[model samples]
Target: MHSINDAAGKILSSRQTVALTGAGISTSSGIPDFRGNNGLWKTYNPSIYAHINTFRSDPALVWELAFMLHDLAASTAPNEAHVALAGMERSGLLQGIITQNIDSLHQRAGSRNVINYHGTVDSAECTFCRIGEPVRRAALPVCSICGRTMKPGFTLFGEPVPPSAYLEARNLASYSDVFMVIGTSAVVQPAADLPFIARENGAFIIEMNSEETGLTNYITGCFIKGPVEQTLPLLVNKLNRRN
Candidate 1:
Protein backbone atom coordinates (compact mmCIF):
# COMPACT_ATOMS: atom_id res chain seq x y z
CA MET A 1 0.00 0.00 0.00
CA HIS A 2 2.75 2.42 0.89
CA SER A 3 4.66 1.38 -2.19
CA ILE A 4 1.64 1.95 -4.38
CA ASN A 5 1.18 5.43 -2.94
CA ASP A 6 4.82 6.24 -3.54
CA ALA A 7 4.67 4.92 -7.08
CA ALA A 8 1.53 6.91 -7.79
CA GLY A 9 3.17 10.01 -6.40
CA LYS A 10 6.16 9.53 -8.66
CA ILE A 11 3.95 8.96 -11.69
CA LEU A 12 1.85 12.03 -10.96
CA SER A 13 4.93 14.18 -10.66
CA SER A 14 6.88 12.78 -13.57
CA ARG A 15 6.81 14.41 -17.00
CA GLN A 16 6.82 10.97 -18.66
CA THR A 17 5.95 7.59 -17.23
CA VAL A 18 6.32 4.37 -19.22
CA ALA A 19 5.37 0.78 -18.49
CA LEU A 20 7.24 -2.28 -19.69
CA THR A 21 4.92 -5.26 -19.42
CA GLY A 22 5.43 -9.00 -19.71
CA ALA A 23 3.54 -12.31 -19.82
CA GLY A 24 2.65 -12.17 -16.14
CA ILE A 25 0.43 -9.18 -16.81
CA SER A 26 -1.80 -11.38 -18.98
CA THR A 27 -1.79 -14.53 -16.84
CA SER A 28 -4.99 -13.50 -15.09
CA SER A 29 -6.67 -13.28 -18.47
CA GLY A 30 -6.20 -17.06 -18.81
CA ILE A 31 -2.98 -16.79 -20.78
CA PRO A 32 -0.01 -18.74 -19.48
CA ASP A 33 3.46 -17.23 -19.64
CA PHE A 34 6.33 -18.89 -21.45
CA ARG A 35 8.76 -19.41 -18.53
CA GLY A 36 6.66 -19.99 -15.47
CA ASN A 37 6.47 -23.31 -13.64
CA ASN A 38 3.64 -24.44 -15.88
CA GLY A 39 4.53 -22.12 -18.73
CA LEU A 40 3.73 -22.96 -22.36
CA TRP A 41 7.43 -23.24 -23.14
CA LYS A 42 7.79 -26.17 -20.75
CA THR A 43 5.30 -28.25 -22.68
CA TYR A 44 5.82 -26.97 -26.23
CA ASN A 45 9.61 -26.67 -26.33
CA PRO A 46 10.15 -23.32 -28.07
CA SER A 47 13.30 -24.59 -29.79
CA ILE A 48 11.21 -27.09 -31.73
CA TYR A 49 7.95 -25.17 -32.11
CA ALA A 50 8.79 -21.44 -31.88
CA HIS A 51 12.15 -21.09 -33.57
CA ILE A 52 12.38 -19.52 -37.04
CA ASN A 53 14.35 -22.50 -38.30
CA THR A 54 11.55 -24.83 -37.30
CA PHE A 55 9.02 -22.40 -38.73
CA ARG A 56 10.89 -22.26 -42.04
CA SER A 57 11.53 -25.98 -42.32
CA ASP A 58 8.06 -27.00 -41.21
CA PRO A 59 5.58 -24.14 -41.33
CA ALA A 60 2.75 -26.62 -40.95
CA LEU A 61 4.27 -27.75 -37.67
CA VAL A 62 4.69 -24.14 -36.57
CA TRP A 63 1.02 -23.50 -37.25
CA GLU A 64 0.14 -25.86 -34.45
CA LEU A 65 1.60 -23.43 -31.91
CA ALA A 66 0.47 -20.35 -33.81
CA PHE A 67 -3.12 -21.51 -33.99
CA MET A 68 -3.11 -22.36 -30.31
CA LEU A 69 -1.86 -18.87 -29.42
CA HIS A 70 -4.44 -17.28 -31.70
CA ASP A 71 -7.29 -19.21 -30.11
CA LEU A 72 -6.11 -18.36 -26.62
CA ALA A 73 -5.84 -14.64 -27.41
CA ALA A 74 -9.22 -14.82 -29.12
CA SER A 75 -10.77 -16.43 -26.07
CA THR A 76 -9.40 -14.21 -23.30
CA ALA A 77 -9.90 -10.54 -22.51
CA PRO A 78 -7.40 -8.09 -21.01
CA ASN A 79 -7.23 -8.19 -17.22
CA GLU A 80 -7.28 -5.24 -14.81
CA ALA A 81 -3.55 -4.59 -15.12
CA HIS A 82 -3.97 -3.95 -18.83
CA VAL A 83 -7.08 -1.86 -18.25
CA ALA A 84 -5.30 0.26 -15.62
CA LEU A 85 -2.44 0.98 -18.00
CA ALA A 86 -4.86 1.95 -20.75
CA GLY A 87 -6.74 4.20 -18.38
CA MET A 88 -3.49 5.85 -17.32
CA GLU A 89 -2.56 6.49 -20.93
CA ARG A 90 -5.97 7.96 -21.70
CA SER A 91 -5.79 10.22 -18.66
CA GLY A 92 -2.28 11.41 -19.65
CA LEU A 93 -0.57 9.86 -16.65
CA LEU A 94 1.40 7.41 -18.79
CA GLN A 95 3.46 8.02 -21.89
CA GLY A 96 3.07 4.55 -23.44
CA ILE A 97 3.62 0.85 -22.93
CA ILE A 98 6.39 -1.39 -24.23
CA THR A 99 5.22 -4.97 -23.98
CA GLN A 100 6.88 -8.35 -24.37
CA ASN A 101 3.53 -10.01 -24.98
CA ILE A 102 2.05 -10.99 -28.33
CA ASP A 103 -1.44 -11.23 -26.80
CA SER A 104 -2.57 -7.79 -28.11
CA LEU A 105 -4.29 -7.27 -24.79
CA HIS A 106 -2.86 -3.77 -24.35
CA GLN A 107 -4.36 -2.61 -27.63
CA ARG A 108 -7.62 -4.40 -26.94
CA ALA A 109 -7.76 -2.71 -23.55
CA GLY A 110 -7.67 0.70 -25.30
CA SER A 111 -4.00 1.63 -25.00
CA ARG A 112 -3.12 3.59 -28.14
CA ASN A 113 0.66 3.96 -27.87
CA VAL A 114 1.75 0.38 -27.42
CA ILE A 115 5.09 -0.93 -28.66
CA ASN A 116 4.69 -4.65 -29.03
CA TYR A 117 8.32 -5.69 -28.82
CA HIS A 118 7.53 -9.35 -29.52
CA GLY A 119 4.98 -8.62 -32.30
CA THR A 120 1.32 -9.73 -32.18
CA VAL A 121 -1.01 -12.71 -32.61
CA ASP A 122 -3.70 -10.74 -34.42
CA SER A 123 -2.30 -11.72 -37.87
CA ALA A 124 0.32 -13.70 -39.76
CA GLU A 125 2.94 -12.33 -42.13
CA CYS A 126 3.93 -13.86 -45.45
CA THR A 127 7.61 -14.84 -45.77
CA PHE A 128 7.90 -14.10 -49.45
CA CYS A 129 5.35 -11.36 -50.04
CA ARG A 130 5.98 -9.56 -46.72
CA ILE A 131 2.29 -8.98 -46.40
CA GLY A 132 0.09 -10.01 -43.47
CA GLU A 133 -3.37 -11.51 -43.05
CA PRO A 134 -5.65 -12.30 -40.17
CA VAL A 135 -4.94 -15.67 -38.61
CA ARG A 136 -7.52 -18.32 -39.42
CA ARG A 137 -8.27 -21.57 -37.65
CA ALA A 138 -10.02 -23.23 -40.56
CA ALA A 139 -6.76 -24.28 -42.19
CA LEU A 140 -3.02 -23.70 -42.30
CA PRO A 141 -2.98 -20.16 -43.73
CA VAL A 142 -1.21 -19.49 -46.99
CA CYS A 143 -0.05 -16.14 -48.37
CA SER A 144 -2.43 -14.49 -50.80
CA ILE A 145 0.27 -12.68 -52.77
CA CYS A 146 2.83 -15.43 -53.43
CA GLY A 147 1.10 -18.62 -52.23
CA ARG A 148 3.84 -19.09 -49.63
CA THR A 149 2.97 -20.06 -46.08
CA MET A 150 2.34 -17.16 -43.74
CA LYS A 151 4.28 -16.92 -40.50
CA PRO A 152 2.60 -16.08 -37.26
CA GLY A 153 2.92 -12.42 -36.36
CA PHE A 154 4.75 -13.12 -33.12
CA THR A 155 8.56 -13.00 -33.27
CA LEU A 156 10.12 -16.44 -33.51
CA PHE A 157 13.34 -17.48 -31.70
CA GLY A 158 15.72 -16.73 -34.56
CA GLU A 159 14.02 -13.55 -35.76
CA PRO A 160 15.22 -10.09 -34.78
CA VAL A 161 12.88 -7.81 -32.91
CA PRO A 162 11.15 -5.48 -35.35
CA PRO A 163 13.64 -2.64 -35.83
CA SER A 164 11.00 0.09 -35.88
CA ALA A 165 9.30 -1.12 -32.73
CA TYR A 166 12.63 -1.43 -30.93
CA LEU A 167 13.57 2.09 -31.91
CA GLU A 168 10.32 3.47 -30.55
CA ALA A 169 10.63 1.50 -27.34
CA ARG A 170 14.26 2.55 -26.93
CA ASN A 171 13.34 6.18 -27.38
CA LEU A 172 10.53 5.86 -24.84
CA ALA A 173 12.83 4.24 -22.31
CA SER A 174 15.50 6.82 -22.78
CA TYR A 175 13.11 9.71 -22.35
CA SER A 176 10.82 8.47 -19.60
CA ASP A 177 11.19 9.98 -16.14
CA VAL A 178 9.34 7.15 -14.44
CA PHE A 179 9.48 3.52 -15.59
CA MET A 180 7.34 0.70 -14.30
CA VAL A 181 8.30 -2.92 -14.84
CA ILE A 182 5.30 -5.13 -14.34
CA GLY A 183 5.03 -8.93 -14.17
CA THR A 184 8.38 -9.70 -15.80
CA SER A 185 11.32 -11.56 -14.37
CA ALA A 186 13.81 -9.41 -16.25
CA VAL A 187 15.72 -12.34 -17.69
CA VAL A 188 15.19 -12.40 -21.45
CA GLN A 189 17.61 -10.35 -23.50
CA PRO A 190 16.85 -7.24 -25.55
CA ALA A 191 13.38 -6.81 -24.06
CA ALA A 192 14.89 -7.30 -20.60
CA ASP A 193 17.29 -4.43 -21.21
CA LEU A 194 14.49 -1.83 -21.33
CA PRO A 195 14.33 -1.19 -17.59
CA PHE A 196 18.10 -0.86 -17.47
CA ILE A 197 17.94 1.61 -20.30
CA ALA A 198 15.39 3.65 -18.37
CA ARG A 199 17.59 3.40 -15.29
CA GLU A 200 20.63 4.58 -17.21
CA ASN A 201 18.62 7.53 -18.43
CA GLY A 202 17.80 8.40 -14.79
CA ALA A 203 14.26 7.12 -14.66
CA PHE A 204 12.88 6.20 -11.29
CA ILE A 205 11.85 2.54 -11.38
CA ILE A 206 8.80 0.91 -9.88
CA GLU A 207 8.22 -2.81 -10.10
CA MET A 208 5.07 -4.89 -9.65
CA ASN A 209 5.41 -8.64 -9.70
CA SER A 210 4.45 -11.73 -7.73
CA GLU A 211 8.06 -12.04 -6.64
CA GLU A 212 11.27 -10.09 -6.67
CA THR A 213 13.22 -10.00 -9.92
CA GLY A 214 16.64 -8.71 -10.90
CA LEU A 215 15.25 -5.23 -11.43
CA THR A 216 13.61 -5.39 -8.01
CA ASN A 217 17.00 -5.93 -6.41
CA TYR A 218 18.96 -3.45 -8.47
CA ILE A 219 16.96 -0.56 -9.90
CA THR A 220 13.48 -0.57 -8.37
CA GLY A 221 12.81 2.33 -6.06
CA CYS A 222 9.37 1.07 -5.09
CA PHE A 223 8.74 -2.67 -5.17
CA ILE A 224 4.94 -3.01 -5.20
CA LYS A 225 5.07 -6.71 -4.59
CA GLY A 226 1.87 -8.54 -5.61
CA PRO A 227 -0.07 -9.79 -8.59
CA VAL A 228 0.00 -7.07 -11.27
CA GLU A 229 -3.78 -7.35 -11.82
CA GLN A 230 -4.35 -6.21 -8.24
CA THR A 231 -1.46 -3.79 -7.73
CA LEU A 232 -1.84 -1.82 -10.95
CA PRO A 233 -5.46 -0.85 -10.31
CA LEU A 234 -4.51 0.25 -6.84
CA LEU A 235 -1.81 2.47 -8.28
CA VAL A 236 -4.33 3.96 -10.69
CA ASN A 237 -6.76 4.63 -7.88
CA LYS A 238 -4.05 6.35 -5.89
CA LEU A 239 -3.19 8.52 -8.86
CA ASN A 240 -6.83 9.45 -9.28
CA ARG A 241 -7.13 10.36 -5.64
CA ARG A 242 -4.08 12.56 -5.82
CA ASN A 243 -5.58 14.40 -8.77
Candidate 2:
Protein backbone atom coordinates (compact mmCIF):
# COMPACT_ATOMS: atom_id res chain seq x y z
CA MET A 1 0.00 0.00 0.00
CA HIS A 2 1.42 3.40 -0.99
CA SER A 3 1.25 6.23 1.53
CA ILE A 4 -0.65 9.39 0.61
CA ASN A 5 2.66 11.26 0.53
CA ASP A 6 4.04 8.73 -1.92
CA ALA A 7 1.00 9.25 -4.13
CA ALA A 8 1.45 12.99 -3.91
CA GLY A 9 5.08 12.67 -4.84
CA LYS A 10 4.13 10.58 -7.82
CA ILE A 11 1.64 13.27 -8.90
CA LEU A 12 4.25 15.99 -8.48
CA SER A 13 6.65 14.11 -10.72
CA SER A 14 4.11 13.26 -13.41
CA ARG A 15 3.95 15.42 -16.52
CA GLN A 16 0.17 15.29 -16.86
CA THR A 17 -2.27 14.51 -14.06
CA VAL A 18 -6.04 14.55 -14.42
CA ALA A 19 -8.81 14.24 -11.83
CA LEU A 20 -12.27 12.69 -12.19
CA THR A 21 -14.74 13.78 -9.52
CA GLY A 22 -18.38 13.16 -8.57
CA ALA A 23 -21.05 13.93 -5.96
CA GLY A 24 -18.92 12.84 -3.03
CA ILE A 25 -16.53 15.76 -3.61
CA SER A 26 -19.38 18.24 -3.24
CA THR A 27 -21.00 16.62 -0.20
CA SER A 28 -18.68 18.66 2.01
CA SER A 29 -20.04 21.81 0.39
CA GLY A 30 -23.48 20.97 1.84
CA ILE A 31 -24.70 19.16 -1.27
CA PRO A 32 -26.04 15.67 -0.65
CA ASP A 33 -25.11 12.69 -2.75
CA PHE A 34 -27.72 11.39 -5.19
CA ARG A 35 -27.55 7.74 -4.13
CA GLY A 36 -26.47 7.98 -0.51
CA ASN A 37 -28.71 7.86 2.52
CA ASN A 38 -31.14 10.81 2.44
CA GLY A 39 -30.25 11.22 -1.21
CA LEU A 40 -32.44 13.07 -3.71
CA TRP A 41 -33.27 9.78 -5.40
CA LYS A 42 -34.88 8.57 -2.17
CA THR A 43 -37.50 11.34 -2.33
CA TYR A 44 -37.82 11.78 -6.11
CA ASN A 45 -37.84 9.22 -8.85
CA PRO A 46 -35.19 10.02 -11.48
CA SER A 47 -37.43 8.70 -14.22
CA ILE A 48 -39.81 11.57 -13.56
CA TYR A 49 -37.49 14.38 -12.51
CA ALA A 50 -34.32 13.58 -14.46
CA HIS A 51 -35.07 11.54 -17.57
CA ILE A 52 -34.95 13.16 -21.03
CA ASN A 53 -38.36 11.83 -21.98
CA THR A 54 -39.86 13.33 -18.84
CA PHE A 55 -38.21 16.69 -19.61
CA ARG A 56 -39.66 16.62 -23.15
CA SER A 57 -43.17 15.61 -22.07
CA ASP A 58 -43.49 17.32 -18.67
CA PRO A 59 -40.81 19.97 -18.25
CA ALA A 60 -42.55 21.49 -15.25
CA LEU A 61 -41.93 18.34 -13.26
CA VAL A 62 -38.24 18.42 -14.15
CA TRP A 63 -38.07 22.12 -13.22
CA GLU A 64 -39.38 21.39 -9.75
CA LEU A 65 -36.26 19.35 -9.06
CA ALA A 66 -34.18 21.82 -11.03
CA PHE A 67 -35.34 24.70 -8.86
CA MET A 68 -34.41 22.76 -5.76
CA LEU A 69 -30.96 22.04 -7.19
CA HIS A 70 -30.54 25.65 -8.22
CA ASP A 71 -31.20 26.82 -4.69
CA LEU A 72 -28.75 24.26 -3.34
CA ALA A 73 -26.04 25.32 -5.77
CA ALA A 74 -26.69 28.96 -5.06
CA SER A 75 -26.41 28.52 -1.30
CA THR A 76 -23.42 26.17 -1.16
CA ALA A 77 -19.78 27.30 -1.19
CA PRO A 78 -16.80 25.33 -2.42
CA ASN A 79 -15.24 23.03 0.18
CA GLU A 80 -11.57 22.35 0.97
CA ALA A 81 -11.40 19.48 -1.51
CA HIS A 82 -12.53 21.80 -4.30
CA VAL A 83 -10.05 24.46 -3.18
CA ALA A 84 -7.23 21.93 -3.09
CA LEU A 85 -7.85 20.81 -6.65
CA ALA A 86 -7.97 24.40 -7.84
CA GLY A 87 -4.69 25.10 -6.08
CA MET A 88 -3.15 22.06 -7.75
CA GLU A 89 -4.23 23.43 -11.10
CA ARG A 90 -2.73 26.84 -10.32
CA SER A 91 0.49 25.19 -9.22
CA GLY A 92 0.59 23.26 -12.50
CA LEU A 93 0.61 19.87 -10.77
CA LEU A 94 -2.82 18.97 -12.19
CA GLN A 95 -3.71 19.15 -15.85
CA GLY A 96 -7.49 19.30 -15.63
CA ILE A 97 -10.62 18.20 -13.80
CA ILE A 98 -13.43 16.16 -15.36
CA THR A 99 -16.44 16.30 -13.07
CA GLN A 100 -19.72 14.42 -13.10
CA ASN A 101 -21.36 17.13 -11.01
CA ILE A 102 -23.42 19.96 -12.48
CA ASP A 103 -23.11 22.27 -9.47
CA SER A 104 -20.25 24.39 -10.93
CA LEU A 105 -18.24 24.22 -7.70
CA HIS A 106 -15.05 23.47 -9.59
CA GLN A 107 -15.38 26.68 -11.56
CA ARG A 108 -16.35 28.54 -8.40
CA ALA A 109 -13.20 27.27 -6.71
CA GLY A 110 -11.07 28.78 -9.50
CA SER A 111 -10.18 25.72 -11.57
CA ARG A 112 -9.67 26.98 -15.10
CA ASN A 113 -9.40 23.67 -16.93
CA VAL A 114 -12.61 22.02 -15.80
CA ILE A 115 -14.65 19.77 -18.06
CA ASN A 116 -18.20 19.52 -16.86
CA TYR A 117 -19.16 16.04 -18.04
CA HIS A 118 -22.76 16.41 -16.81
CA GLY A 119 -23.10 20.03 -17.99
CA THR A 120 -23.83 22.95 -15.64
CA VAL A 121 -26.79 24.45 -13.80
CA ASP A 122 -25.72 28.05 -14.48
CA SER A 123 -27.52 27.94 -17.85
CA ALA A 124 -30.34 26.15 -19.67
CA GLU A 125 -31.35 25.30 -23.22
CA CYS A 126 -34.63 26.03 -24.92
CA THR A 127 -36.10 22.67 -25.85
CA PHE A 128 -37.99 24.18 -28.78
CA CYS A 129 -35.30 26.20 -30.54
CA ARG A 130 -32.19 24.76 -28.83
CA ILE A 131 -31.11 28.26 -27.82
CA GLY A 132 -29.15 28.75 -24.61
CA GLU A 133 -30.29 30.88 -21.69
CA PRO A 134 -28.72 31.88 -18.41
CA VAL A 135 -30.31 30.20 -15.41
CA ARG A 136 -32.32 32.54 -13.21
CA ARG A 137 -33.23 31.30 -9.73
CA ALA A 138 -35.67 34.11 -8.93
CA ALA A 139 -38.28 32.44 -11.12
CA LEU A 140 -38.48 29.81 -13.83
CA PRO A 141 -36.90 31.26 -16.97
CA VAL A 142 -38.53 31.01 -20.38
CA CYS A 143 -36.90 31.21 -23.79
CA SER A 144 -36.80 34.69 -25.29
CA ILE A 145 -36.38 33.36 -28.82
CA CYS A 146 -39.36 30.99 -28.87
CA GLY A 147 -41.32 31.62 -25.65
CA ARG A 148 -40.69 27.95 -24.83
CA THR A 149 -39.60 26.49 -21.50
CA MET A 150 -35.90 25.85 -21.08
CA LYS A 151 -34.26 22.66 -19.85
CA PRO A 152 -31.30 22.68 -17.52
CA GLY A 153 -27.98 22.38 -19.36
CA PHE A 154 -27.10 19.18 -17.56
CA THR A 155 -27.24 15.79 -19.21
CA LEU A 156 -30.59 14.25 -18.28
CA PHE A 157 -30.95 10.66 -17.08
CA GLY A 158 -31.54 9.35 -20.61
CA GLU A 159 -29.55 11.92 -22.58
CA PRO A 160 -26.06 11.14 -23.75
CA VAL A 161 -23.16 12.99 -22.14
CA PRO A 162 -22.04 16.02 -24.15
CA PRO A 163 -19.78 14.88 -27.00
CA SER A 164 -17.15 17.65 -26.74
CA ALA A 165 -16.66 17.30 -22.97
CA TYR A 166 -16.50 13.50 -23.27
CA LEU A 167 -13.90 13.60 -26.04
CA GLU A 168 -11.67 16.12 -24.24
CA ALA A 169 -11.83 14.14 -21.00
CA ARG A 170 -10.96 10.93 -22.85
CA ASN A 171 -8.01 12.60 -24.50
CA LEU A 172 -6.73 13.95 -21.16
CA ALA A 173 -7.12 10.56 -19.49
CA SER A 174 -5.34 8.79 -22.33
CA TYR A 175 -2.30 11.07 -22.16
CA SER A 176 -2.13 11.46 -18.39
CA ASP A 177 0.75 10.06 -16.38
CA VAL A 178 -1.44 10.13 -13.26
CA PHE A 179 -5.20 9.81 -13.21
CA MET A 180 -7.02 10.46 -9.95
CA VAL A 181 -10.56 9.27 -9.29
CA ILE A 182 -12.06 11.38 -6.54
CA GLY A 183 -15.32 10.74 -4.70
CA THR A 184 -16.96 8.88 -7.63
CA SER A 185 -18.53 5.44 -7.22
CA ALA A 186 -17.31 4.38 -10.66
CA VAL A 187 -20.70 2.82 -11.49
CA VAL A 188 -21.97 5.35 -14.01
CA GLN A 189 -21.24 4.56 -17.64
CA PRO A 190 -19.07 6.57 -20.05
CA ALA A 191 -17.53 8.68 -17.27
CA ALA A 192 -16.86 5.46 -15.38
CA ASP A 193 -15.08 4.07 -18.43
CA LEU A 194 -12.41 6.81 -18.32
CA PRO A 195 -10.34 5.12 -15.63
CA PHE A 196 -10.12 2.00 -17.75
CA ILE A 197 -8.92 4.08 -20.66
CA ALA A 198 -6.26 5.73 -18.49
CA ARG A 199 -5.22 2.36 -17.10
CA GLU A 200 -4.96 0.82 -20.56
CA ASN A 201 -2.93 3.77 -21.72
CA GLY A 202 -0.43 3.28 -18.83
CA ALA A 203 -1.43 6.05 -16.42
CA PHE A 204 -1.14 5.40 -12.72
CA ILE A 205 -4.69 5.24 -11.37
CA ILE A 206 -5.36 6.62 -7.89
CA GLU A 207 -8.64 6.30 -6.00
CA MET A 208 -9.52 8.72 -3.20
CA ASN A 209 -12.85 8.08 -1.56
CA SER A 210 -14.47 7.59 1.82
CA GLU A 211 -15.08 3.94 1.07
CA GLU A 212 -14.26 1.28 -1.49
CA THR A 213 -16.00 1.75 -4.82
CA GLY A 214 -16.76 -0.75 -7.58
CA LEU A 215 -13.41 0.10 -9.19
CA THR A 216 -11.41 -0.09 -5.96
CA ASN A 217 -10.33 -3.68 -6.36
CA TYR A 218 -9.57 -3.81 -10.04
CA ILE A 219 -8.52 -0.49 -11.56
CA THR A 220 -6.82 1.45 -8.76
CA GLY A 221 -3.05 1.60 -8.32
CA CYS A 222 -3.55 3.19 -4.87
CA PHE A 223 -6.65 3.45 -2.68
CA ILE A 224 -6.68 6.18 -0.01
CA LYS A 225 -9.68 5.81 2.26
CA GLY A 226 -11.03 9.02 3.85
CA PRO A 227 -13.25 12.00 3.20
CA VAL A 228 -11.90 14.02 0.26
CA GLU A 229 -11.83 17.21 2.34
CA GLN A 230 -9.26 15.58 4.58
CA THR A 231 -7.33 13.47 2.08
CA LEU A 232 -7.07 15.98 -0.74
CA PRO A 233 -5.56 18.75 1.40
CA LEU A 234 -2.98 16.35 2.72
CA LEU A 235 -2.10 15.26 -0.79
CA VAL A 236 -1.81 18.88 -1.93
CA ASN A 237 0.40 19.79 1.01
CA LYS A 238 2.71 16.91 0.23
CA LEU A 239 2.88 17.98 -3.39
CA ASN A 240 3.58 21.57 -2.37
CA ARG A 241 6.61 20.52 -0.32
CA ARG A 242 7.97 18.46 -3.21
CA ASN A 243 7.50 21.35 -5.60
lDDT over C-alpha atoms for residue 96 of model 1? 92
lDDT of 1: 0.90
| Pairs with backbone N, CA or C atoms under 3 Å apart (clashes), candidate 2 | none
Per-residue lDDT tens digits for candidate 2, residues 83-178, read 999999999999999999999999999999999999988889886787887788755678998888788988899889989998999999999999
- Model 2: lDDT of residue 171: 100
TM-score of each: 0.96, 0.96
- Best of the candidates, TM-score: 1
Off by over 4 Å in 1: none
Instruction: Estimate the lDDT of model 2.
Output: 0.91
lDDT tens digits, residues 1-243, model 1? 237888888999999999999989999999998887999999899999999999879988788998888888999999999999999998999999999999999999999999989899888998788888888787878888788888999899989998889899999999999998999987888988889999999999999999988777688898998999999998899999997
* Candidate 2 Cα deviation (angstroms), residue 183: 0.5
